[model samples]
Target: MTSLLRILRFAPQLNPLYLGIAVSSVLAALLSLATPFLIGAATDRIVDAVAGRTGVAEAVTAVTWLAVAFLAVEVAATAVVSVGGYWGDVMAARMRTVLSTRYFEHLLHLPQRYFDTALTGRITNRLNRSITELTQFLQFFANNAFTMLITTAAVLVITGFYWWPLAVLLAVVFPVYMWLTAKTSTKWQVWEGEKNTEVDVASGRFAEVVSQMAVVRAYNRQEHELAGFRERFTKTVGLTRTQSRFWHGMDAWRRLAMNVVFGLMYLIVFVRTAQGLFSVGDMVILLQLMNMARQPIFSMSYLVDSAQRAVAGSKDYFAVLEEERERAGGRALEAGEVRAVPNGPAEARADVVEGETVPLPADVPAVRFTDVTFAYDDDAARPVLDRVTFEAGVGEKIAFVGESGGGKSTITNLLMGLYPVGDGRIEVFGNDVAGLDLAAVRGSIATVFQEPFLFSGTVRENIAYADPDATDERVRAAAKAAYADSFVEGFDHGYEQIIGERGLRLSGGQKQRIAVARAVLKDAPILVLDEATSALDTRSERLVQAALEELMVGRTSLIVAHRLSTIASVDRIVTLRAGRVEEIGTPAELSRSGGIYAQLLQLQQAGTKEAKRMLKEYGIHG
Candidate 1:
């Protein structure tokens, strides 16, 4: 119930629509109350005519008027119900929109680590399940809740007027049935939660298998994956069977209780009519009201069913929404407040405006990592980077060469603020990264990763991702610089060519070049190439390396490379071993220093089997 209330709070603008539905529902229900009375009056008129107690013409006239009034009331009620239904449908749609939008926005603000540890499909599955149940319940309640209450109230009042005992019998059934249903609430919800877990895991795995179908086929594990998927859903089926039996078992008892009370009411009404204590018309009206009361009474079970599912679904939804959002950039200060820039002159105090770019001081290095340390979120895991320190001067190109898991990529990830450093500081252009606006810090850098991820969109769309508003000419120029323009022009649609998911339709080189083109289009002051060309063939490597060289000029470039040839032209090389910096020097100086870098360089130059063994021993890739 609390979760349902929280869901409603997500869309306050729908309040007026909800109120309108309630109003229409009440009007419809009140007008419907005239139905039984009109029918009873007509029945009494016929009885009088047949018994010769009233003149035929007068009896016919009364019956005719009663029919007309009943028709008018039914028409009005229908119109009111139609309006309420329309408003309910509209509100439900808008509720879904608001919920989905807010959930997606929340995800965008979550920390990167959240994505690392969570499955893509599981996250989306929660959103779909939660919003679907909430929207449905909201729509159902809007259309039926007020009408049910009003009808039930009218039944109580009318029954009391005819005979107070009949009202007592009808009212007693409601609480008794409700109490019986409440007994199963805890157990029902427990089963629902357990079923949801199996469903979510299956959904997550389903998405993962689909996305990696190529790998599955390559390894001939299609049967294995299918078995796993089936096993998960099979468990859900077993749970549903047990859950259904319990719910319906309780519902059977509730229905039996209601039927027994209704039978007693009927006997009392019949006995009174025969005893001359009430007219046949009075008996008719009482029975008709009882039937009306039954509708809402039966509907109680359905509403409870929906409410339980809604509560359970919303529990998961609210849990995600309640998580602490990733920290954002600092707000702009007042005019008199001082904004300190670390490593800046102590005498200098400045006012910082929100969302405005402030240039770095000229003398500050483009990038700096001072005694930085980090580890993944595992108790047994060692630090990936331990007190690693390095700096890149403005417009200088530095390369990091190391064995696998030697912290080469970790350095760039820290500089980009993807993960928090455990100790020490990372400064981007002389500002402590911890306090600087993350958007501003990341805006000045562009990265080309080893695995280029492209959406299923047009080439133009992917390239313009860096700057959505960039003109066609700028996009083409960037593509040309990355040597992708020629191949793009060869396509049937030129720049408008549709690139399949992750550019699956294109070759590896083509995909890498497209990624390079995106980075070129960004044109940030700092560039990061994390094994960007390592996966390409010889010819593709040359082409991409050339494009990278063109992109690196006049910018501060951070290069993590396995092939020594790629770093031969870098201004300096930083060699790492076992999460620590082993050596840092110019390419020529490191080549002769007999350090890790020199040994790897010497081994790479030799193509013999012994050289390969030595390289493998160091876990270095040639």
Candidate 2:
């Protein structure tokens, strides 16, 4: 109940309407009490007429007007309830929209480390479940709570008129009812929270397996994957069943107790009527009022369950809401004229700026990592980037060559401001990357990841994502530069061809080229090409590499390549070992020096026999 109050604080706009609903529901319950009294009065008047009492005609007239007024009040109460229902629906819709929108915005600003620890499907599930429960809470819980309160008050007040003892007895039981409700609801709340977590885990596992079905098939590990999924599913089912059973047991107990209490009330009412304490009409009114009180108790029990579910769902929702956003530091970058430095590397110069060594702007480095360190968990002793430092300057391409889990992509993420720096600072344009506007930083760079993502739109739209306002001429030129226009033109719809979700309709190379075209259109000063040509065939690779070279001419470029030959043309080669920079120098310099980069180059030049021997020694294979 306290949780419900706290959650309502997020949506204060609905408070007035909620108050109105409560007031109307109370009025309706009060009016409903009159029906019983009117019937009792009419019954007594008829009894007087039958007993030869004086002024029977006036009594009959008064009874008729009382009955008419009772009917009118009942009709008005029904109208108010109907209007309250409509308002409840409207409030639910508005809350769903506002909370869902805020949730999305929060997701957009959260640090990349959050995603590193969280699963995409799980985050999505939490968002969906939270909004759904929140809507239900607003629509049903608020109105029902008000109805329960009014019903309880009406029952007590009406009972006081005929017999104060019955009213006092009900008042005594109210606290017991509330306590039991709170205890059972607390247990259910904990169970519900666990159930929600299990559901998210199951969803995450299922989505991961489905998305990587190709890898499973290639390895012929279908049975193994199925076994793992089944295990996870079984655990989730067990948790769900446990949660359901507990709630069912609690509900059964509540119903049995309620029945016993109502039976006692009925017995007391009957005894009072038999003693001539009240007329038959008075007995009917007492029974009706008791029944009304029972309705709220039953409803309250049901509401406890609903409230538990909402609490569980809200925990997940607020987790997202409470996530830390990208630190803006209330600082905006100076919108000065950006100039291209001629006869220079187009990267920031490695010189002291305010007592800190900043990268060269003329070099226009694809990226610069300056003693950067990061960890998803604050308690983690080993950082993902352990004082890692390097620079890939303009017209100077660099490749990150290392074993998997060597923090290659972590460096890329830091450069992109997807994650915040924990130890040392990073700079891009003679400005602290931390202080730079994230949009402005990303706007100056383009990336083509290993797995290219495409929206559900036409090919033209996908390529033009880098620059939504790009002209047709610019789009066509970019496509040509990426060597994608020829193949696109060959297609039936050409630029208008629709690509399915994530470009699943297109082949790997086709998607890669389209991604390249999108990046080319942006024409950013820096480019990060992560396995851009790794998915291409030999012929496609040759053409794509040519296009990439053209795009890399004036901009700083960072390329992560799997094939050794693909990186031979890069100006510098940086070898990473366990999250730390092991070697950094030009390809020619490193190859002649016989370091980690040289050994890799030598292994690449060797035949299959030596290559296999090298892989056996280094524990790496093609």
Candidate 3:
């Protein structure tokens, strides 16, 4: 109930339309009350002529006037209801838009850790189910809530004027039926929640399997996945059956109670009229009013059902909204400044006027990491990074080389502020990362990941992702710089060719080159390449590596590589093992030092003669 009330808190902005619907519904209900009175008058007049108490001519004239009034009232009620219904439909659509946009905006602000734990499909399912149910209930309530209230009240008053006992009988049904329904509410909601869980999990798996259909077929796991999906839905069906049985069983009891009460009221009305205590006209009106009361009593049950579902839906929707949003500030960066971070004390440098270039000071780096430690799981005993300290000077091409899961990628992630730091400091462009604006930091840095993630759009769009407003000429130049222009030009539509989801339509090297071109267009002062060419074949790797070389020039680049030979030309190599830094030196120095770098080099040279020759050519003598 509280959750449903919280949903109403967002309705104030649409209060005028809400008020309009209420007023119209009330007016229609009032007009509709006139029908029974008009019919009752016509009936009495006809009875008088039949009993020879009045002339047929006078009776027919009275009945004709009443029939005309009844027609007018019915027409007016219909028109009022139509107008209210129109307002309700419009309000419901706008509410859907408001709720969906609010949910999406909050989703974008939630920290990365939220996405890491929640399934994408399940998150999407919650939004769809919750918003759909809520808006439906809201629209129904707006159209019928006031009408039901006014209609039931008028029936009670009109019936009581004729017979108080009938009013008492009608009133008793409400509390008894409500109590019966209330007794099952807690259990009903519990079942609803369980069914929702089953549905969400099954839907999540459905989406996952669809996206990875190639892998499922490759491994011949289609039957296995289908069996899992069916098992979940089977559980959902069983739960739904049980729930329906309970609800309908209670409904049967409620209807029986209503029927018995109405029968007594009807018997009383007939007996009292025969004893001359009530006239035929009075009896007719009383019975019709009682029938009207029956409608609202039945409608109450439906309203309760809708309210219950709405409460459940609002609970799920607001739960996500209550989550902590990311507090990272939005700050833009200045262009053409060589900010420095000193290893020891601060060094004095000349300050220049606005937009003037400053020379980078000696022994000062563009980026610095000091004793940084982090772990994905807070309860885990071993952290992913342990007191890792490193530096990348301005315009220096530094590479990190290590085996799998050696925290090489973790360093890059930390530098990008993708995860919160556990201990120690990280500085980008002489500013501590924790205190600096995240947007400004990210603005100066560009990253190319191992597997390029591109949206399903044109090749030109993918290249311009780094700068959405970039001109066609600028896009072409960046593509040319990355050596992707040749292949792109060969496509049927050239730059306008549609790349499928995650660049599925493009070859592996083609995807990587487009990613490289995006970074090239960004032209940031700092570049981070995380195994960019590791997933390609020899020819593709050569092409991608050549493009990467062109993109990395004159920038502070950090390369995370598994292939030893690929990073041989870097200014320096930082070797890591088991979350700890093992060695830091130039490729030539580390090759002769017999550290992790030398061991990996030896392993590479132990392969084919061509591999050995490649290692030797990269200045590795093992």
Candidate 4:
């Protein structure tokens, strides 16, 4: 119930039109109340005419007038209903648009970990179902539920006028029904929660399998994936059956209770008619009123159940909405200048590389991590980065080199402020990153990942993503700088060629170069290449590495490099081992020290040779 109220706070309002809808609803309901009386009177008049107690002409006239009046009222009620329904739909559409957009904006602010760990289908299911269910509930409450209440209230009023005792009986019967319903609805809520969870699991499993179609085929696990999906499907079917049966069981019990009361009311009215205390017309009204009341009573379980489901769905939606967003900070960023806090002087550092340690010049480094430590999970035994510290002076190029799981990539994630850091401060321009406005901090840097992702758009559109309002000439210049202009111009449509999803239509070299072009266009003070050329072939890697060099020239650059060419000219190489920094020095300096950095470099050289030998055997290399 609380969740339902919370969801309704987003409900669209018709403002002054609500009064019109209400007036129309009340007028329609009142017109309906006239039915029982007019019907009863017409029946009595025919009886009176047949017995010669009333004149034939007068009886016909009275009956004709009554019919005309009923017709007019019915026509008026229908018109009122049409207007009311139109506003109801308007409100429903507005609510759906507002709620869904709010959910989207909330997701934009969510931390990266949410996307990392949360199931795609579960989040989508919750988002989709909440909006759908809430919309239905709102429409039902505004129209059908409102109509049912007015009809019930009108019946109660007429029933009391016909006979006080029947009204009193109704008052007693429905209160008991409501009390039982309240208890049953509590149990239904529990079941409904479980049912929704099962649905999300089934939805997520289907999505996961479909999205990983290549992996399933490559691994020959089609049958295994099918079995997994079937298991979830079977569980959801069972839950659906249970939900259906529970609702019907409760509905049947309530119907029986309502019918029993109705039967008793019939007997009471029959006795009164026999005693000559009431006319046949009065008995007609009594039965008509009870029938009207019966309809709402029959629909009670459905309305109550919908309310419960809406409440549960709203809670699911809010669960995501209520999560904490990236914390905001006080620092402002300028377009050309980047703020990077340098680590304390490398004095007393165990991981110091053997060479004269150069303190990053104090012009406020473009990027800095000082004793920064963090673990992806609190229960993780060892943090991913332990007391890791580094700094890049303005326009200085630094590279992180290590084997996988040694935390080379974690540095980029931290610098981008994608995750929260707890142990130490990361400074951008001397301001603690934790205290700097994240939007401004992120806006100050550009990143190109090993897997270059492209949206489904034209070649020109992809480049312009860095600055949507960039001029055509500006975009072309950026592309040329990354060495992508030649390949792009070769396309049949030139820059207008539509790239397939994630640039699947482009070669590895082409995609990486376009990604670099985007970074070039962004022209931020800082650039990060996280294994950006590692996945390419020799030719592609050479092209992409060359493109990266042009992009990094005037920016503070951080590279998590896998190739010797990428590290050869870096100002400093920071070596990581088991989540701690092993050394920081020039690539030449580290190679001479014969430490962890030198050993990893040697292994990579061997792998490169083996790869070349394999390529030569395949006639692709000399």
lDDT of 2 by residue, 1-622 (tens): 5656766776788788778777766776676667777777777777777778748788879788988887898898788778878777887887788788778877876776688789888988888888898789768865667777877987897798778988987886677776777877776777677777777877787778777778889999889867876776777678768877876787778778778877888998898889988777788878888887878877776676677788788888877777666654323212121322212354852222111222346735546678888886788778777898887666668888776667777777778878778888776765677765566567677888877788879899999998788899999999999989988998899999988877878877788888889989988878888877766787887788788888888877887776666667888888887778889888778888877777876676675787867644433334
Instruction: Candidate 3: give the clashing pairs.
Output: none
Q: Which of the numbered candidates is closest to the native, going by highest TM-score?
A: 1
Cand. 2 TM to true fold: 0.84
lDDT by residue for model 3 (408-472), tens: 88898888777778898998767777765454566678899999988899999999987888899
RMSD of 2: 6.4
TM-score of 1: 0.94
532-568 per-residue lDDT for model 4 (tens digits): 9867888988787788888888888998776665677
**Model 4 alpha-carbon drift over 4 Å, by segment:** 11-21, 330-362, 490-496, 601-622
Error of 4 at 602 (Å): 4.2
Candidate 3 Cα lDDT to native:
0.83
> Which ten residues in a row are the worst by lDDT in model 3?
349-358
User: How does residue 130 of candidate 1 score in lDDT?
Assistant: 88
Name the runs in model 3 displaced over 4 angstroms. Answer: 329-364, 608-622
TM match of model 3 to true structure:
0.89
Candidate 2 runs further than 4 Å off: 45-71, 214-257, 330-367, 373-386, 402-405, 490-496, 563-565, 577-583, 612-622
Clashing pairs in 1: none
State each model's C-alpha RMSD to the native. 4.0, 6.4, 6.2, 7.5
Worst 10 residues of 4 by lDDT: 349-358
Clashing pairs in 4: 339-428, 339-429, 340-366, 340-429
